[model samples]
Target: MRELTIDWTALHSAFQMNMPEVRCFLSVEDGKVQKLPPGDPNLATVRADPQHFIPIDAIPSRIQYQWLDDFIKALEDSVVRERMEAAINGKGAFRRFKDILLTLPDERRRWFEYRDQKMRERIVEWVREQAIVPLNEAPWSADLPEGSPPYVSAHIDEDSLGNLA
Candidate 1:
């Protein structure tokens, strides 16, 4: 793939200049048009408040887990290092190893994404953590009323209490 170095701000401004009437409120400012606050809940609010809204294309949305970058780098470094060592031992060509190293970025990204569902898990966790809605607590096994079946009947054990009642 061709490497694209995007000037996000320039692209965004150009987009706005070309299509000034793009009817999206990016955010609200003092109850008017403004940028959306971090972890903003509504896309409609964002579209209406363009001043505060960051265009979708403006941001790099690399969803990665905290340690994924380091972990992937270490893994790739080890692979390249081993290949280099093998080349020094006359098992492979140094140029081949170098090329392999150069091509590792896509591989590393795939590995990171596959290994942990990296960005998705982190984003979901972040959204859940930042959500305004209250999460319902899991029903306690011992608290279930006598007549009620267990919340997870398949997992209930013979000795289990239904709920915390």
Candidate 2:
């Protein structure tokens, strides 16, 4: 496996970005993530050198919706869970779900923590898939059991959750 000094934060942001108008890539030479808008002159150069620049795909919306559903399922408060279930039923569900979380400071904090943990697990899986052995220690690796894989063991079923829209 090739070892590189990766900017983990930049990589995490690249994975989280889901905008249609932007594209992200990871520079194997420097292990930094690059975001380029359409028509950028440098994009052509990056695309040309496929060996040095690897395209980063954004996490699908279906997977994110599953995260929201799983979080709602784990909540102990039935009232809050019901509100969240309703909030995610139609258009603008992401915004509505966030709005409800904003009113509850503790739940809001918990949501952020949950989301970050899920994203970190995704990042670890992506890194391993790319055959990268990061030279810098990953912040999330500290909690892993000895000899265990660096990823969390949550299953994200895209088709099982159906459409949240």
Candidate 3:
């Protein structure tokens, strides 16, 4: 079986899609993913070419913007929600949200860290479930310092080799 790999750093940006657009994009039929153009006959009228339909299994990744919903609703009730809705409709949801977050530097930093960690954890779990073995050295490992060689060898007792024979 082939495994899908996702970069965690991209999740926040991907979640910025508007609800209706995201919903329609994620909707599935006949095991195909759709990329419908605006006002296409299928989107406007009806379809026989259901091949473009998004798979139901892939829907969650498409429609996960609730983190933003919580953020804005808590910040300011109706007004903030309206602004965010407008920003989403205008296709600048993430940019507008970040703009609002910028006004509160500490909160913005905390939000970013929290989101990054969440995405990283999720990706790590998926990677483990898929049995992927990462070959490259992790950046923070004590065995490797900046500018050090990636490989190392240590002296061992020669007598140990005789056990193999």
What TM-score would every model get versus the actual structure? 0.26, 0.80, 0.34
Give residue 124's lDDT in candidate 3 (0 to 100): 41
The reply for model 3, stretches above 4 Å from the true place, is 1-64, 70-90, 132-165
What is the model-wide C-alpha lDDT for candidate 1?
0.34
- List ranges where model 1 is wrong by over 4 Å: 1-68, 73-116, 132-165
Candidate 2 versus the native: TM-score? Answer: 0.80
Ranking by TM-score: 2, 3, 1
Question: Which lDDT tens digits does candidate 3 get at residues 1-165?
Answer: 222323222322233334444323222222122444566666643244333332122224333355555444444347655766665544666777778777767546645544443443343444354343333332222222355433211121222222221
Per-residue error (Å), model 1, residue 20: 16
- Model 1 lDDT per residue over 1-165, tens place: 111222323322332332333332212122122333445567565655544443432213132222333333344357654654454334344344445546777543444344332232232232233231212221232343356433211222213312212
Top candidate, metric lDDT = 2
Stronger candidate by TM-score (2 vs 3): 2
lDDT by candidate, in order shown: 0.34, 0.79, 0.40
Please list the residue runs of candidate 2 whose C-alpha ends up more than 4 Å from where it truly belongs after superposition.
143-165
**Per-residue lDDT of model 2, residues 1-165, tens digit only:** 778888888988898887877889999999998999999999999989888998998888898999899989888899999999999998899999999998988778777767776787788788888888888866555544566554332433323222211
